[model samples]
Target: MSDKLTPEKRSWNMSRIKGMDTKIEVEVRKYLFSKGYRFRKNDKRYPGKPDIVLPKYHVAIFVHGCFWHRHEGCKDATTPKTRTEFWLEKFDKNVKNDQIKQEKLKEMGWKVIVIWECELKKDFQRIMDRLEQEFKK
Candidate 1:
């Protein structure tokens, strides 16, 4: 479907979108905190400015929005029909940047974890359990 908002309006709406402290990120943080996991948020010292960093475990967690991060095969990861080329280019760049960040974090001896926004909506417990397993590693 075509965009309902004018270009100016769309720009304003997009500008309001946040890069950090998102709802899903907050949810994950709460859960982890409740589970006795101490973490630092968006540590400047790390690649990608991970949403949650556990220094004790040498782990970095990123809570990614499906559309923004283009979670592979995720239902929420839909391409915008309005600007095909623009969206594709943007998404591709996002994916590439994410990969680079992950590689960099790995090279720095940090276990990287990515949690999709959709996962927080359904079966969030699974993500928590997987985190537990990762922590145990």
Candidate 2:
């Protein structure tokens, strides 16, 4: 199917999408800070520039949007009807990169945590509790 928006409009919309300091990322950061969990945001020294880095716990957290990160079985992970192949390839690359980056972090002895956007929407409190437990461990 063809795109509903004009090409120029679509490009403009895509350009407006933020790559860093997204809404979900900020929310997680605020929660961690309020709980006294000191962290660095998008530390460039890390493999994937993790959204949150807890140096004390040696942990790296990635706040991923379900659609962009291609969260498996997630309702929000629908592909665009237009340019199906391009979107598929992009999603595949994102998933692969995530795995590679997480693996590298683990090899460096850092605990990696991925927080999906949908999970935060569905059960924010539960996810935060689990995150706290990870730090405690």
Model 1: residue 42 alpha-carbon error in angstroms: 0.6
lDDT of 1 at 96: 96
**1-137: candidate 2 lDDT, tens digit per residue:** 68889999999999999999999899999998999889999999999999999999999999999999998899999999988999999999999999999999999999999999999999998999999999999
Evaluated at residue 65, the lDDT of candidate 1 is: 97
Residue 133 displacement in candidate 1 (angstroms): 1.5
Encode model 1's per-residue lDDT on 1-137: one tens digit a residue.
78999999999999999999998899899999998999999999998899999999999999999999999898889998887999999999999999999999999999999988998799999889988899999
Best by lDDT: 2
True-vs-predicted CA distance for residue 112, candidate 1, Å: 0.5
Q: What TM-score goes with each of the models? A: 0.94, 0.98
Model 2 bad stretches (over 4 Å): none
User: Number of clashes in every candidate structure?
Assistant: 0, 0
- After superposition, the stretches of candidate 1 with alpha carbons farther than 4 Å from their true spots are none
